[model samples]
Target: MQAVDQPERRATPTIRYFVRDLDAAVDFYRQLLGFEEELRPNPVFAMLYRGDLRLLLSVPGTYAGGHALPDGTLPSPGGWNRILLQVVDLDAAVEALRRAGVHFLDDRPSGVAVRQVLLEDPSGNPIELFEPATGYHERAR
Candidate 1:
């Protein structure tokens, strides 16, 4: 019998969102959030990165697995399943995004625990930017 060893993981994995229009999605994220393209699979595919987070975009028929949603068939308004981003300064982030012409749905401070701003991307995906309260730590189960 052979013994197997699992490799160690260093950092938290990133989430990838698929978009119908890769170029438009990439441009929106890069311009609105200061993320840069770290990789381009071709003219039709690209990976944008900000800090430790990553977003992959591709044109139709470019990626395998999950099928693409047809035009005009996306989820209805407020049907957004949001992606959360932890930032050091919530206000500054919101201001920058605002200056870039990004629409903000809400920018409210929730107690002293977090201040968050909700915004939607060109593809109607919602993203939440938040600042953690002081002395906060992730609890282990």
Candidate 2:
């Protein structure tokens, strides 16, 4: 059998968040969420990465991804749907963020699976920080 050449591949998950202010969004992700800026092609678009997660920040009026529907409804930020980030110490993380003037929606324990705290980005996009409980594996089963 002859060997075949294969193209390189990578699996880095990405999510796009529509924001009103591109610079503010970049600062929030870079300083608070620990995402390093990957690229800023222009004023309208920027990319940030943390581990395997790539975040795309787009300004509604300038970026194509933030374009309105044919019905004339414009894209906007803020919704219950959110990005979940797993943390080792949920409480400590929450406290630190709170001290830095970040606002949290709530801080609660989700039974035995995980302890979660919800916060919003500058544009009001939700982000959940959770720490799995010690018995999380058992509860998951």
Full-model lDDT for every candidate: 0.69, 0.85
lDDT of 2 at 125: 94
Over 1-141, each residue of candidate 2 has an lDDT whose tens digit, in order, gives 749764578657889899989999999989888899999989989999988999899988664488878898878899898889988888888888989888788866465577888899989999999888888688678
Model 1: per-residue Cα lDDT over 1-141, one tens digit each: 649664586654565565666677888888777678988867666877887777766554544222446763332223456778888888888778878777777766565566677887766667888887766555422
**In candidate 1, which residue ranges exceed 4 Å CA deviation?**
1-7, 60-79, 135-141
Tell me which residue pairs clash in candidate 1: none
Candidate 1 global lDDT = 0.69
> What lDDT would candidate 2 get against the real structure?
0.85
RMSD per candidate (Å) reads 5.5, 5.0
Query: Which lDDT value does model 2 have at 47?
Result: 90
Once fitted onto the true fold, the runs of candidate 2 whose alpha carbons sit more than 4 angstroms away are 1-10, 138-141
